[model samples]
Target: MIDLHGFGNQLLQGAVITVELAFASLIVGLILGLLGASAKLSSIKALQWIANAYTTIIRGIPELLTVLIIYFGATSVLMSVASLFGYEEYIEIGPFVAGVTALGLTFGAYATEVFRGALQSIPKGQHEAAVALGMGNVRKFYRIILPQVWRMALPGLGNLFLVLLKDTALVSVVGLDDIMRKASIAVSSTKEPFLFYSAAACMYLILTIISMVAVHYMEKKASRGIKRT
Candidate 1:
């Protein structure tokens, strides 16, 4: 009974952590995504190869595998760097940072595909028109392509973000005290796996519901003045 109350708070905190992880990853991933999409679209051979490798390698691996590899591998690399600097106590990558990095890497890979499709969807005439008007590539992208790309990509990006948010629960495997982790502790103490797990499910559902609302608002805002069927 007493433990249940505390468990509830723990789960709530974990849910918040999960949301923060998702948002942070999404922001970082968006930058990678835009660059990668541009690379794929560009005629630059080297940039295109790098971008293609990023998406292919990430997409080929399981998300859980990516998290595990990055969490452990990153810490190892960081410790090596710190040791080179002769300040080696221990270099630790906390759960939050690990969670964000893993998710960001995975999300960026997926986002690249979404952005690519959106970029291709634009009529070639638009780019030609911008060029004919003497607008530079950078200016044309910011003034024209970005707006439409964002609008077109929002639906796909929103879908990917929701998946990223849910997958944050898996970060517990790397010892992240995410909601699922806290719930597991509570279940062990209470010997009520069903109850605690069910509660955790509800918490996740709540997050999903909130995301849906936000996504809808965003789609509407992005699509303003553009007709949809």
Candidate 2:
């Protein structure tokens, strides 16, 4: 066991922060993804164009650039807005908030496609059958379509989540004090780059393993009662 040299608790705290960041981003991304998918599927051409532009622009840019843009851009925009309101003080954005916004936007961009594909994969007959049963559109969607969509989308979302988990490290660049940032601090203090960095890697690996197990369990539960080919 490689000793953490009294930085164990710090690293653990950072790991917890990382988990918090990932979960917060996941929530934001899920909401955006649903809206994006809905817009793309809607009959409104304007909504489809807006959704397409969002996904395309976000996906085309580097994730790191997004983080930097949100971090600095938010501060700049807030400061400008504050100036108009006669508040002259400099405005700042929290790293956590910026990180979540940037990472969530990136995640949502990809998740939009995953959700769109999942929504399209459902059989049209099932929808017609629901309508024939006198179910309203909202009711049919919630009662019949949603469950299948969730099952179909789970694997893709699971993969996106793992990527998002790793992307949490990007927040460290903005001084969020996540696992990577904590490790960097430890390395600077103790001058043991290998030791602290390795510890950080281990922590991330542990998180990934746990996430994978949870995802697998969710997938299994979601697929329950479905006949397998």
Q: Report the Cα RMSD per candidate.
A: 2.5, 2.2
Each candidate: what lDDT? 0.88, 0.95
Tens-place lDDT digits, model 2, residues 167-224: 9999999999999999999999999999988899999999999999999999999999
Q: Clashing residue pairs in candidate 1, if any?
A: none
Q: Write the per-residue lDDT of candidate 1 for residues 108-213, one digit (tens) a residue.
A: 9999999999999999999999999999989999999999999999999999988988888889888888889988888888899998888888888888889989
TM per candidate comes to 0.91, 0.93
Alpha-carbon runs more than 4 Å astray in model 1: 1-5, 79-91
**Highest-lDDT candidate:** 2
- The runs of at least 3 residues in candidate 2 whose Cα sits more than 4 Å from the true structure, single-residue gaps closed, are 1-3, 78-92
Residue pairs with backbone overlap in model 2? none
Q: How many residue pairs clash in all the candidates, one count each? A: 0, 0
